[model samples]
Target: MGVPATVSSTSSTLPWNVHRLPRADGSVFLVTGGNAGIGYFVAEQLSATGATVVLGSRNPAKAENATASIRARIAGARVRTVRLDLADLSSLQSVVESLEVECLDAVVHNAGVALDDPPRSETPDGYELMFGTNHLGHFALTWWLMPLLSAAPAARVVTVGSFAAKSERLDLDDLQSRKGYQPKRTYGRSKLAQMHFGIELDRRLRAVGSTVASVVVHPGGALDSLTPSRPPIHVPTTGARLSAAPAALLVQGKHAGAWPAVRAVLDPAVLGGQLWGPRVFGLRGEPRREPVWNHLADTSVAARLWDASCDLTGVDPGAIPG
Candidate 1:
C-alpha cells in the first residue's frame, strides 16, 4: 500500500518529532521493560520532556543502569528504578504495594519478550511464556494499579502492541498454547490479546464512568541499527550490524519507533479505545490513529479474553469501582 496523506476517516498523517511533545514536568510515568529497546527510548524521550519516570525491569542493576543513562543524557532528569518481573504475580504485587504515590499519570505497558526463540516451557504462572509475559503480566499489573490510575484526574494506560497482531488469530481453547506454539504466532496472539484488552478496557472504563484512557499502539518495525550505538544499553554484535546494514532502509530507529506509544500516552486529543501505529505499511512512518482491524474489533472475542484474563490473573475487572 502506498503511503497516503491520511490513513482512514478517523486519522490523518501525523508528522511528529519527539522534541515537539509538551513539557511533562509534574507528571509521573511507569514504564515496564524501560531498560532497552523501544521501552528504553520511550523512557529517554519521556524524561527528556521532564516527566518523573519509574523505570521497571526484572533486573535491578539493568534498571539502575538505564536510570543512570537517562540521568546522564538529560541532566537533572528525575528517575527511579523498580524491580518487576511480569511473569511473576508475586513480583507484580510486591512492586505495587511498594509504590509510595497514590496516583500515576500513565503506565506504559512496554515490556515483553519479543522475537526470541519459542519458549521451551511456560511461565511460573503456567501460561505460554510469550502470552504470560506480554499480555497476562500487563493485565495483572494494570488491574492492581486501577485504584491509583482511577485516582488521577485523567490517567492514561498505553499498551504496547505490535504488527504481529495484524496477522494472528487467538485460540480461545488454548490461550496458553498447550496445544501448539510457534514463536511468531505466539507473539502475535499475545499482542492481539493486548489490543483486545485495551479496547475493552476503554469500553468498561466508560461504562463505569472512569476517566482513565486506554489506548494501544505499535512501534513500527524498529531495527537496532536504526537506533543509536549506545554502549552498555545496546552494543550490537558484528553479525547484528551486518544484518542491520541491508535492512536499515526498511526499518526506522527506536527513537522514531517510540513516537506512537509516547503519543498514545501524552496526546490529549487521543481518545480511549483508539489504536495508533505507523502510516506506511504499518511498519514505518508517522503515527496515525488507524481503524481497528476486523478481528481486533470482535467484542465477543475481547469479552471472552477479558474473562479468561481475569480468571488467569485473579484480577477482577469489575473490582474497579464504577
Candidate 2:
C-alpha cells in the first residue's frame, strides 16, 4: 500500500532538529522498559531537558543501571527508577501509587515483548504475552494515571508503535491469538492494537474536552549493531559496528529510533491523534509527523479495540476525569 498523506507537515524552512530540544524544566515523565533498547535512549534524551525521568522496569537492578548510565552522561540529571511489570495487570495500581510526582507531564509507552518462536506464552493475566505486555499493560497503566496526567497543564501520552503494525489488523474475536499463534503476526497485531488505542484515546479525550494529548510514534527500523555504546548496558563490539556500518544508510540505531517519541513529547506544534515516524521512507532519517496508515485509520475498528481493551484490562479509560 502507498503511504498516506501527513495530517500536517512540519515547516520545511525550519525543520525540527533532534539534537537540540526544548527545555522541560520541572516536568516529570515516565518511560516504560526504560532499562534498555529504545526505552533507555528515550529516557536519556528526556533527561537532557532537565525533566525528572522515571525509568519503569520490571527488574530493579536494570532500572538502577539505566539511571546510572543517564546520570553519567548528563550532569545533575534528575532520574530515578520505578518497579513496573506491565505483564502483571494486578500490580499496576501500586506501581502508579509509587510515583512521587503530583503531576505527570508525559509518558512514553515504549516497552514491549516480541517472542520469536512459539510455544506461545501467556502473561499472568492469561492473555497472550505480546498483546498482554504491549497493549493491555499500557492501557491499564494509562487508566490508572489519568488523574496525575490530567493535573498537568498539557500532558502527552506517547505510545511508541511500530512499522510492523502497518499491514496487520486486530482480530477482535481472538485478541489473544488463541487459535493460530504465529509469533511475528501476533506481535504485529499487538502493536496495531496499541496504535488504535493511541488514536482512539485522542478521540475520547477530545470528546471529554480533556487537555491530555495522545500521540503515536514508530521508530523506523532500529538495530542493536548500529546502536551507540552505553557502557555495561549496551556495548557493541568493533566487528559488529563495522559489519552494520553499511546498513546504516538504510536503518538506524536505537538511539536514533527514540527521536519520534522525544519529539512528540516536546514539540509544541504536535497535536493529539497524529502519527509520527522516520523521514526517509519510514525507515531512517530525522523524525517527522506522518499520516496514519490506511488500515489504522478506521475509527470503528479502533473503537472496537478500545472496548475490548477496557473489558480485558478491566479499566474504563473513558471514565478518566477530563
The top-ranked prediction according to TM-score is 2
Clashing pairs in 2: none
Overall local distance difference test of candidate 1: 0.81
Where is model 2 poorest over a 10-residue stretch in terms of lDDT? Answer: 1-10
* C-alpha lDDT (0 to 100) for residue 92 of candidate 1: 86
Local accuracy of candidate 1 as per-residue lDDT tens digits, 1-322: 0111111212223445557666667777899999988899889888877778888899888887788888889999988888889989767877776667777888999998865675456889787888899999999999888888877767888999988789888999989877666788888899999889888998888888887878889997998877776667887788777777777667788877888988777766677888899878788878888898899889999999999999899886535852
What lDDT score belongs to each candidate, Candidate 1 first? 0.81, 0.89
TM-score of each: 0.91, 0.95
- Can you write out model 2's per-residue Cα lDDT over 23-71, one digit (the tens) per residue? 7778889999999999999999989988889999999988888999999
Of candidate 1, the 10-residue stretch with the lowest lDDT total is 1-10
Cand. 2 TM to true fold = 0.95
